[model samples]
Every structure is written in C-alpha cells, then in structure tokens.
Target: MAVRKIEHVGVMVTDMERSIAFYRDVLGLETLGTLDHGNGTIKLAFLGSPGAGETQLELVQGYTGRLAEEGKVHHIAFTVDDLDAEIARIAKLDVTFIDPDITVLPNGARYRFFYGPDGEWLELFQPA
Candidate 1:
C-alpha cells in the first residue's frame, strides 16, 4: 500500500460563517467551496491558499458529538516564512495564543500555538 499526500484537514465548527471569516480574514485562506453534507445535517466549507495543490482546510458544521479537549483534530499547523511577523499580526486580532513565547526545537525550527474562532488549536511553524 502507498499513500501520496494528505488531501485536506477537516475541522468541526459551530458557526460556518464565523469559521469561514476567521480562516479567511485572519489566516489569509480563501474559501474554495462549500456544500451541504449528504447526511442533510452537516455543512462543509473547503478553504485553501491561492496556489494550486496546497493542502485544503475543510470546516465541518452541525456535528452534534462532543469534541475532545484539544479540538476536532489535535491541531492544524500552517507553514510560515516569518513567524515573528505572523505572531505580531495575530496579536492585534481577537484571538488567544496558547504559547507565551515561540518554541524552538532542537533542529532550530520554531512554532507558536493559538486558538481559532471555535477554540481549535492552530499553529504557525517556521522551519530551520
């Protein structure tokens, strides 16, 4: 068996509009599309960067089940060229940062954690 690459990451959100705005306005991601799930209850919105073939973010709404303490998934990380700049930009928003300061791995990669509109863990990672 062989796996190529991840198609997209799905996140559960309470409000579709709010989630779309947060991922769009705050994170600079564009909404690729949206649709009602065949189940007739869940609504999904797919978002992604402008570039072709970038991993997409899928927002799932109307999920009645309980979410884990962390969120829909453990966390979703976005690659950043300038972590400091991104940190400063997010600071001015009405978001919460999970990390007090940037964390540096042994390889010199740095990352910071923050919360999304629905309390989902989001991260900005800068490679060494």
Candidate 2:
C-alpha cells in the first residue's frame, strides 16, 4: 500500500516549557494540546499550523540533553512564504542560524538551518 503523509515528528525535549514556547510562540505554531502518559512520567505537547491535517511537531518531555546526532535525522524543515520575513521575525527571538547566510541549492531552492530550544536542528526551506 502507498504511504500517506507524515503525521508528526516526535522530538525529545529537555525543558517542556521552553520547547513549547519556542514552537508555539517563536515559530507561531498553534498548540493542539498536551498529553500525559506513563502516569505523568511522560509529557507531550502537540503543535502545528492552523488548518486541518497539517503535519504536527510533537515535543516530548522526560528526556535530558539533545538526542540529535550526526548521520541522524539532521533537521526538520518548515516551508515559509517569505524566508526573509521569517528570518527577521526569528531574529527577534535571538535564535542563531547555523549558516552565515541562506544557501541556494542547485535547483535554486533556498534554505537555512537553526537550533530549537532543546538544540534540535530545524530548517526553513523555500521552494524555487
């Protein structure tokens, strides 16, 4: 059978509040709500843009430190209508860009990388 689109990306976060703020406030994603599992041993916050069936970013608590490593998932990317506008908005949050400047791929698509509150790699991609 053919596979459907990704439902969400599960991210392990060190600080639930900060991670939620980053995804909800900084990125401007809507909070779908939170979940308590394992009798409160685990906490998860679901976030996504406004609109039905959008892929969500799930932030899970109960982990310490970063989980991303080389040769791993690398980064989660989000599409932006205006990369420059998005960059300016994110700059107010004091987020550091991994690249000195946006990179243009061979196909002419533009992208830049940054880190989330829990040091999770994230990318902003603009199609050609």
Candidate 3:
C-alpha cells in the first residue's frame, strides 16, 4: 500500500458558514471547492494555500454522534512561512484566540491557536 501526501486536514465544525469565514476571510486561504455529501449527512469545503494549492483545509460539518465534544481533538495546526503574519490576518476576523502572538519555543519554532466556532481549535505554527 502506497501512502500519499496529506491531501487535507479534516476539521469538524458545528457551524459551516461561520467556520468557512474564519478560515477563508480571516486567514486569507482561498476556497478550492465545497461539496454536499448527500442526505445532509456531511458537508465539505476545500481551502487552498497561499502558494496556489500547496496545501488545503477540509472543513467538515453536520455529522453528529462521537467526537463532537471536548477531548476528541486538542488542536489542528497548519504550518506557515510567517507565523506572525498569519496570526495577524486571522486576528482581524476577531476569531477568539489563544496567545494572539507567536509563542517561541526552545526548538526555535513558534505557535499559536485561534479558537474556532464550537471550540474547534485552529493553530498556526512555524516548523523547524
């Protein structure tokens, strides 16, 4: 079995439109596409990266039953060229944030989280 590169990261959001705005407008990530997976069971939105498709964010919604509450996922972080710039961009949307600025680590990388709708944590970090 050949494993492929991560196509996108799946995030569970209680509110699709609000989360879309948070990721698209606030973060400046371009929208690639969105799809309704029939019977109102699932909704998906694909977000493109600054480099015009280097990465993506798959926004998933409308699924109930486990993993909807706390402790399921602590956070989901996306790598950025300039963590500071991305942080500032999202801050404009006034999306609730944790450590609004980049926090330095001993390894020389930085990180921060912008709390999303329904407590879905969104993270921006620079990898070493």
Q: Pick the candidate with the highest TM-score.
A: 1
Distance (Å) between predicted and true CA of 12, model 2?
Answer: 1.2
lDDT of 3 at 126: 75
Residues forming the 10-long window of minimal summed lDDT in candidate 1: 1-10
* Cα RMSD of predicted structure 1: 13.3
List ranges where model 3 is wrong by over 4 Å.
Answer: 66-128
Candidate 3 to truth, TM: 0.49
Candidate 1 global CA lDDT score = 0.77
TM-score of decoy 2 = 0.49
Clashes of each: 0, 0, 0
Highest lDDT against the true fold, candidate: 1
lDDT of 3 by residue, 15-101 (tens): 888988898788888777777754657886768766775557878787776673654444566777776777667778887887646
- Candidate 1 lDDT tens digits, 4-53: 34446678888999999998899899988887754658787879997866
lDDT of 3: 0.69
lDDT of 2 by residue, 29-125 (tens): 8888776754577786878997865677878787444654552344576777677878878989999888899977544667678888988777776
Q: TM-scores across all candidates? A: 0.54, 0.49, 0.49
lDDT of each: 0.77, 0.72, 0.69
In candidate 1, list every pair of residues with a backbone clash: none
Q: List the residue pairs that clash in candidate 3.
A: none
Candidate 2 C-alpha error for residue 119, in Å: 21
